[model samples]
Every structure is written in structure tokens, then in C-alpha cells.
Target: MNGRLRELSREESLRRLASVGVGRIVFTHQALPAIRPVHHLVEDDGEVVIRSHDRTALLSALDTVVAYEADSVSGDDRIGWSVIVTGVARRADGADRYRHLADPWADGEPGYVIRIRPELVAGFGLPEDNGHAP
Candidate 1:
């Protein structure tokens, strides 16, 4: 397995992130780092949007900094890419307009729509080598 690691450009990273609808949002809870599996949509402007329940911990995290990560990897081939976006989270203004964008896997209504404006975007990938004897 001979392959080189590469840094994905901002565009490529965003593209890869956008290709997937599920990711993890990391934040602080009770003074400790917490992670939540969430479904997200990458807006045309490069912002990320997700829906949360009114009573969830994420509700209190509004206006705070958080990190969102999305990745894909082939376990057998050991090749994949990961992207992370660090940004501030806030409640979106037009909830009605973007309500359809929130598609959670769980049942029940998501009472809040949150958006993350990326302050930093980074990604990396390992391009796999073709099957051949070296």
C-alpha cells in the first residue's frame, strides 16, 4: 500500500463535505467537549445548517464557537478524506425558509435551526494507489 497524503484545497474540501449529508458537530457541554451526530447541509455560501430540538444542549450553544467535521473512508482500502470547519453557531433568522433543509433521521419536530459560519476550513485526503505490484 504505497500512497501519498495530500492537502485538499478549500474548494475540494467543501465539495467533499457537501457530498455527504451526515457529519458530527463538536462543542462544549458542561465544560467538557461533546460531540453529536447530526445531519447537515452545506449552503451555497459555504455555511452549514442543522436542526436541533428546543430542549437539546445545542440550543444553549448558540452564538458560540464549534467545530463540524465530515469524512469518508474505505476501511478495506484504507483510503479516505476528512474535512473540518471551525465556526460560530447561531440560530438562523429565516427558519421557515430553510425549514425544508432540516431532514433529521429521528422522529419528532426539530424546534431550532442553527447555522455555522465557517471561520476556518481544512481537509486532507489519501489518494489510493492502483492495484499493481511495485
Candidate 2:
């Protein structure tokens, strides 16, 4: 409760993003704000990768600008961090090779790997106001 909200740098934001496994991909489904919860991973080159079924509605997002977000929070202390990545979504190469990175909650098999190049990365954190600089 005593923590302060602070902005996270791009490198720190990407690091925080790589720490989490789940997030939401925001795109247009029917012209309104459409979002889908997804499992994601940060690649060695810093691209954000996400898996989806071949029939997924997320295909509508391909070649378009989209937003992906992930966050971690503590319920009791109300301290947490969130990262949002904005970039163009595109079909990735070697989809079969990255299959093991995600643990999907749905029943269908994932046939696509979507990669988002982090064009604009932004994040914020609510950390306990410790005396030392974060």
C-alpha cells in the first residue's frame, strides 16, 4: 500500500515480459475491442511469440498492428507490474519447432506461431517504496 507507481524502461519492460508466460492479445474481432487470453514466450532475439490453433480467430490479426500484454501481481500486497507490447503480428517460421514453449488450455493443436516485433514497449510497476533505487 505504500509503494509508488513507476515507469519501466524498454529493456526492463522486455525483461519483465519475458518473466511471465501468459497474456492477452488485443485485436479487432468484429470492429470492437477484441481480446484473447494466450500463452506466450519471448524469443532469443526479443520477438514475442504466441501459439494458436490453425482455426483461431487470431488469424484476423495477422499483418495488422496489435497489442499484447502480460502482468504479474500480488493479491495481498497489491503490488505488481504490467507490460504492453505493440507491434505487427505475423506468421512465424518453423512453427513446429516452437511447439514446446506453450502449454495451451484449449483442446486443439496449435499449428501457427505468431511473432510480434516489439516496436513500442511500455511498462509500469507498483513496487514497495523501498529506500534504495529500483
Candidate 3:
């Protein structure tokens, strides 16, 4: 699909990601793996926007590369899926711009947004390895 890029079905991959809203946001701080659980919203342009406070550990390096991992699973039901989006991160500034696009919790105090433009997006369905389980 989508010109045969040797990837998972576009719809399937996107579905796996869209189905979940909570996941771990992995970023590098001092060259070490730093992951924080986050709630994100996916944009139409295929970008993920995560909201957080200025003091959040992940905000230390806005210029660094980041990878966000979101997954959904029901072990009792024997169903699960995970999606990883790897990209560069940058702080989203500007009131109007952020207000229209950003969704931050915690009263917007020192509010900051992390925009991740995935250069590589991988999705996996667990327990069955269906779609694109990676």
C-alpha cells in the first residue's frame, strides 16, 4: 500500500496508533533514555503534539531528538498493540499558535508543548503479530 514502501499497511499502522491516547514519551537527557508517561493528540499532518509543564524533565532539551511510544492492550482479552514515533522535538510557542494546537493540562503554568515529527513510525500488534508487529 501507498506505493509499496515495504512497510505495514498504512491504515493498519495508523489505526494502531490512533486507537490509544496514553503512552510513554521517550527523550534523551544527558545522553540517557528518559521516558515520561503522557497523553497526546495526533495532528492531521502526521505529527504528535504533547503538552507538559516547563519544569518537566523532558523539556530540558527541546532541540533533542525524541521518540514517543503509545500502546493499547488487554491481556485478559488477548489483544494489544503498540506504536512508536521517532522524531525531533521542539517547544511549541506562541499563544495563538499553541492555543489552537496545544492541549496542556495543569493550568498552563510554564506550559510547553513538544512537537514530534516522526522520521520513522513503527506499529505492532501483540500476541498475534498482525498488521505490523515490530
User: TM-score for all predictions?
Assistant: 0.82, 0.84, 0.71
Model 3 lDDT per residue over 43-104, tens place: 77777777766455876658777788876555555435667888888877643455543333
Show pairs that collide, candidate 2. none
Best by TM-score: 2
Which residue pairs come into collision in candidate 1? Answer: none
After superposition on all CA atoms, what RMSD does each candidate show versus the true structure? Answer: 4.9, 4.1, 5.9
**Candidate 2 lDDT tens digits, 74-130:** 656544777899999998887668777664665545567899999999888875522
Q: Give per-residue lDDT, candidate 2, residue 5.
A: 76
- Over 67-133, each residue of candidate 1 has an lDDT whose tens digit, in order, gives 9998885656554778899999988876566566655654555467789998999988776522111
Candidates ranked by lDDT: 2, 1, 3
Give the TM-score ranking, best first: 2, 1, 3
User: In angstroms, how far off is 85's CA in candidate 2?
Assistant: 0.3
When summed lDDT is taken over every stretch of 10 residues in candidate 1, the lowest stretch is 125-134
Instruction: Identify the runs in model 2 with alpha carbons over 4 angstroms from their true place.
Output: 1-3, 54-56, 77-79, 129-134
Best by lDDT: 2
